[model samples]
Structure formats: C-alpha cells, structure tokens
Target: MSGHDHVRFLTKNMRVDLALIAGMIAPGSRVLDIGCGDGSLIDHLFQTKACDARGIEIDMAEVTQAVAYGLPVMHGDADVDLAHYPDNAFDYVVLSRALQAVERPREVLAQMLRIGTRAVVSFPNFGHWLVRWQLLATGRMPMTATWDRPWHETPNIHPCTIRDFFILCEEEGYVVEQWLAADDGGRRTPWRRFLNLANIFGEQGVFLLRRR
Candidate 1:
C-alpha cells in the first residue's frame, strides 16, 4: 500500500507510534507483535506495507477481534509462549505498552530478540516529572491516563524507568539502536538526550534494539 493509505487508516492517537515502528521496518518484512491488543498495529502493517504479520495476545477478546480482521494471532503470554518460535523467525518483534505487565521482562526480551532480528518496545515512563512530583509530594502511587489504575487493581507488575530498561538491556546483551520518548497520546518528546534522567521526567519511551 502507499504511504498515504497507511496514514489514512490510522487514528490520530495511533499515527505517531505506528509511524515510528513503520519507519524501522522494511516493506514486506515478517513481524511478530507480542501483547498485541486488538491487532491494530499488525493490521496496519499488513494492509499498508504488505508486511507478513502475526500476533500473540493473552486477551481472548482481543484475539477474537484480531482474528476478525483476518490477522494471524495466537492466544498466549509473552513470557512463556515466545519460546515456541525458532531463532530469528521474524524480521521484527514488537512489545508495546506490555512489558510493565510481564512477570519476567528480561527473560521475555531475551526471547523476543532471539526470535526476531530486531525488536521495538514501547512503555510508560515511570520517571516523568509529573509522576515524580506526585510521588514526592503525595507519596501515592500514580494514576495518570497511561497508568490509570488503583494500586490494588493495577495490571502493571513491573513498572520501570528508561534507565532500568537500559541497564537490563546491557546485562542481557542487547544493543540500543534508537530511542524515542512520547507523552500520553504518543506525541514525541525531547527526552532522548536525558534517557537515564528520563525516568525522573519522561512520560513514555520507545526503543529500537538489536541482539548483540
């Protein structure tokens, strides 16, 4: 599909993030998206760029929706199911806004990298200035739109910062190819320069990484 067709299919809220991932992926590449809620990204990739797309989702409702769109998807968890794929089965793997909910982030990431040549990961930045201020002053867990859950009801079990992610990546032997920070609606921010410090100030961040 043409670039114009790609842009026309995406909602305003999804455009920036989708474009970021699209930029990194070669046309017609094979892709595997983990935690692919509703398969929106995969659908976009298949419909617009002719990418060979597949998804793994834990949510059955989302799995239904993804299948309804004629997208290939399996019901499974990232931490466990990625082991089924052979080494370098896909050109790219994606984990968007789902890492924080995983029980073993490092393990999942390692598996993802092994299964795909490159990976794109996007997550809420727990170190944004607003979150910091809220914690510093109120001493309460944050409840921003991105993290809109009461402490007792939250699904995110491993909230982390950009610095934490970088350290984890280094220890796991993954190289950071590119990094971008985003706000609530996927709007880009100038937080790349302060990635380590970004945990104290960035709202969200995305990383393009490759296995070492």
Candidate 2:
C-alpha cells in the first residue's frame, strides 16, 4: 500500500502528523511514543504493525483513558522524563506534533536519539507563506488547521520552520534520513526534493532522523 493509503487505512481520527509518524516507523519494532496523547498511534502500531508500543503523555486524563483501553501509557513530561530511558531501548522513538510545545526541544531530541536507533519528529511550520503573510498583513499570528490555537491559549513556545529545524540538526550533528512537508489534509508533497516551494506552501513537516 502507498504510505498515504497505509496511514489513512490505519487511522481515521489521527492527525496528519501522527499518521506521517506512523508511516515512518518500521513494522514490529519496539517503539516509544512521547507526547502520545490518548495512545491512538500506540494502539494502531500494536494492532496493525505488531509493534510493542508504549507512550508517555503529560496529561493524567489521557493516561487514564489510554490505560483503560489497555494501552501502556505513563503520565510523564517529555522535557523531564525522556532522560530516564536507557540508551538504545527501542528501535524508534517518536515525537509527533509536540516538538514546538516541549520546553527543551533540542534536549528532548538528543534524549530521543540516545534512547532509540531512529527518531521521528513532526511539527507545524511557522514559515509557511500564510503565516508570513498574516504577520505582515495583521501583525498577528495566523490561524491554520495545524496551528489553530490562539497565541494566548497555545502550548507551543518554540515554533520553528523546516529551515530552522535543518539548522538545528546540523548544529547538533544529526542525520536527516528522510523528511517531507505535508498539508493539513495529510497529503505529503515532495518537500524534501523541492524544499524551497515546500517551505512556503507546506503547513507541517515530518522527519526521520538519527545522530551522526
């Protein structure tokens, strides 16, 4: 099946970023999902890919709900608890759509790469043309599906663009194995191949990475 078809087939309720994260993972791999929300992706991975999936969410309510559904989830903060995992404990560590919200994005990514052979990270892009135009037009934050929350009500503290992330990876000596820019509709374009266009048009991005 195509990647989009696989993601669409696996989950109808998942966000586009989560679907892309799922598509990046290898089947039957041990996976750690940070900021996994209510464990929809974890559940999907376990049932569909035969993965031994576990999740860490900061929300107690979400943890409760996921536990009730028989998903292995712990109420934990990504910024604080990611350090506790031993090195190379999982095949893939995923942080989907939560990178900008984390207190220490660089630190969390370092820990993720340390604990797993591969890491999947996804987040909304602040450099989209709409955002830039909105800032220029109204001098205010733009409202899009991926970044719909108002500035006062949002958890995101460190919004970055695809270019910004690339610079961060370069500084941290991480390797970008694969990356793509996706629209809010879960459709992925050749963002990696045609990056300049993607940076302006793509609403979000997903990346598969490892340490150098």
Candidate 3:
C-alpha cells in the first residue's frame, strides 16, 4: 500500500507523526520501535500491516500496559540497551518523539542504523518560527502543542531543528530517503519542499533514513 493510503487507513486520533512513520514501513517487514510508549505503533503495524513489530520502552509502567494488551514490548532504555541487539536484527528501527531525550543522540542514531536497514525518526522542530519568536520576545524557552512543557519539567535535552538533523545526517553519512514537515493535525506543511520555509513553519519533522 502507498504511504498516503496507509495514513488514511489509520485512525485520525493517532499522532500525525506516528501515522507518518507507519506509512513509511513496508507491509510484513520487521520493525523495532524504541521508546514505544504503550506500543501504539507496534499494535497498528501488527494488526494493519502484518509486520513483525515489537517495542522497547524505558518506562516499566508502559511496558506492563502494553504486555497486558498482548502486545510484544519490553522494559528497556534507548540510551544503553540498544547495544544488546545484534547487528541488522530488523528491517526498520523507529525512534519517534524521543530523540531529544536520549543522553547520547549521536550514538543512539548510529546504533539504530546498525541494527536495522532503515530508521524512521520524528521530533518537534525547535526552529519553528513560533519557537524563535517566543524566545526572542520573552527570552525564554518556547512552548507549543508539540513542545508543551516548561523548561524545568520537560524531558527534552538535545532538541534540534530540521536543519540540525539534516546536518547530522550529512556529517554521519546517513542517506535521507524521504522527509517532510508537519503539524499534529496531520497536515503537511505547505512549504515542506522548501527547507528554509518549512523550518520556520513546521511544528515537527519526520525523516526516513538509511546508511550510506
């Protein structure tokens, strides 16, 4: 099925980014989701796409909840536990909305590519115009629907812009196969084709990548 069609197949309530990530995976592929809170994506992949989908979440509470639902999920940390997996264990390794919280973002990304043929990542764009304007106007960290946490209370530590991620990919020799900017409403930013404009307007960025 086409990515757009897969997006349509999913419930509207799923986070736009998660729907996008789901769209990227091929049917019946193996997928591993890091920081898979509640295993929502895993459930969707298994049920809708017939994927061998499982998750590793840092929160034990979420792990238990996922297990209770009969989903395959385990309590594990993305920062350190990723190393336990063998090389090229899955077709896709997904890290959604949790990139900023990992203590070693670079290392974690390297591990993702090492263990899977491709990686799908989505994160809030810290370079959105609203974020920049709020910081400039109020001299404080900005908050939006996607970044709805106070500075002291938020788990994000390495928040990055779309441009920043592109640079990282380039520097690390990772190939960006597909990318887009969107908001929580599932609407792709009109300027998604234009990086500069998208960076200023997109609430979040989603990327499909593979090793060079």
Q: Which candidate wins on lDDT?
A: 3
Go through the candidates in order and give each one's C-alpha lDDT. Answer: 0.77, 0.82, 0.85
Q: Note the residue pairs that clash in candidate 3.
A: none
Q: Residue by residue across 35-95, what tens digits does model 1's lDDT show?
A: 7667888888988899998998876776787799888998887878999999999999998
Which tens-of-lDDT digit does each residue in 1-212 have in candidate 3?
Answer: 11222122222324667778998999999999988777899999999999999998876666788899999998888888899999999999999877877789999999999999999998878999989999999998898766676887667778999999999999999999999999767678789999999899988889999999
Question: Of models 2 and 3, which has the larger lDDT?
Answer: 3
Which has the higher TM-score value, candidate number 1 or candidate number 2?
2
Pick the TM-score winner.
3
Segments of candidate 1 deviating more than 4 angstroms: 1-16
For model 2, residues 1-212, the per-residue Cα lDDT tens digits are 11222222223325666668888899999999987777898998998899999998876766788899999999888888888999999999998877887778999999999999999988878989989898899988887666666887666778999889989999999999999998877688766578788889888888999988
Off by over 4 Å in 2: 1-13
* Number of backbone clashes in candidate 3: 0
All candidates: CA RMSD in angstroms?
6.3, 6.0, 6.3
Q: Compared to the true structure, candidate 1 yields what TM-score? A: 0.89
Shift in Å, residue 48, candidate 1 = 1.8
